[model samples]
Target: MTLPLNPQRVSVDSISKIKELSGENIKACMQCGTCTVACPMAEEMDFFPRKVMHFSQFGMLSRMEDINSYWKCASCHSCSVRCPRGIDIAKVMESLRLLVLRTNKNYIEPSQIPKEKLKEYPGIMMVAGFRKLTS
Candidate 1:
């Protein structure tokens, strides 16, 4: 007996885990391309919003990690609003980013910056920048 080739099924465990982490129905996506079309920064992504959705649905965890789409996402909610499946795509992107951020790897450290530059920047800017850079 031969099994049918289906890349999506190969990583069902990953799909389920991602769904649990993101709190979204990973199987609800129908690959309508609406998310990619509605994304404001789609052009900047290595794999657009729809492709990232597919990556999650298909349990392609390695593909998901290799792509830079999650980082490129602007969290504008445009894709989420346009999704026919009503999936919160922004939250999915947030989950992907969180997976990377929560691994004890801070993208930036405050001490690395010069005191003069830190003082020169506005308070709100520093706060927001640190928020994105640290965690």
Candidate 2:
């Protein structure tokens, strides 16, 4: 599927778990906005919860940067927990963020991590890096 932006041009690497950890079947989303209402950061987003899914489904990642909703998710999991579709919305966000990070990019302004701290948080990075489910 060649999207307008041509996600193939974007090259979503580093997110080996794109189809694993998230497990958020976009087909299940009905754009009901329940996830938005349940999201703690919906009020501060450029696009509501449903929009995020739309963007991801279409691979229009730039929309995520235009809004703070992605970062605001806070991984509260309220949306996923309450979703009638049982989609893992928070994990979806993480996958989006992970893919974005892969292309040497970020949705947040002034995005940077202190290199000196990489070794300090080895365990945290380890878990985040190997999030893929093999079985």
Evaluate all candidate structures by whole-model CA lDDT and list the values in order: 0.76, 0.62
Q: 47-119, model 2: which lDDT tens digit per residue?
A: 8888887666554544455456665667889999888888888988776655555555534322244666556
Clashing pairs in 1: none
* Candidate 1 off by > 4 Å: 1-10, 108-122
lDDT, residue 40, candidate 1: 88
For candidate 1, write residues 82-115 as lDDT tens digits: 8889999998887777666776555457889899
Compute each candidate's TM-score over C-alphas: 0.77, 0.61
Q: Deviation in angstroms for 52 in model 1?
A: 0.4
Which candidate number would show the highest TM-score if scored against the true structure?
A: 1
Worst 10 residues of 1 by lDDT: 1-10
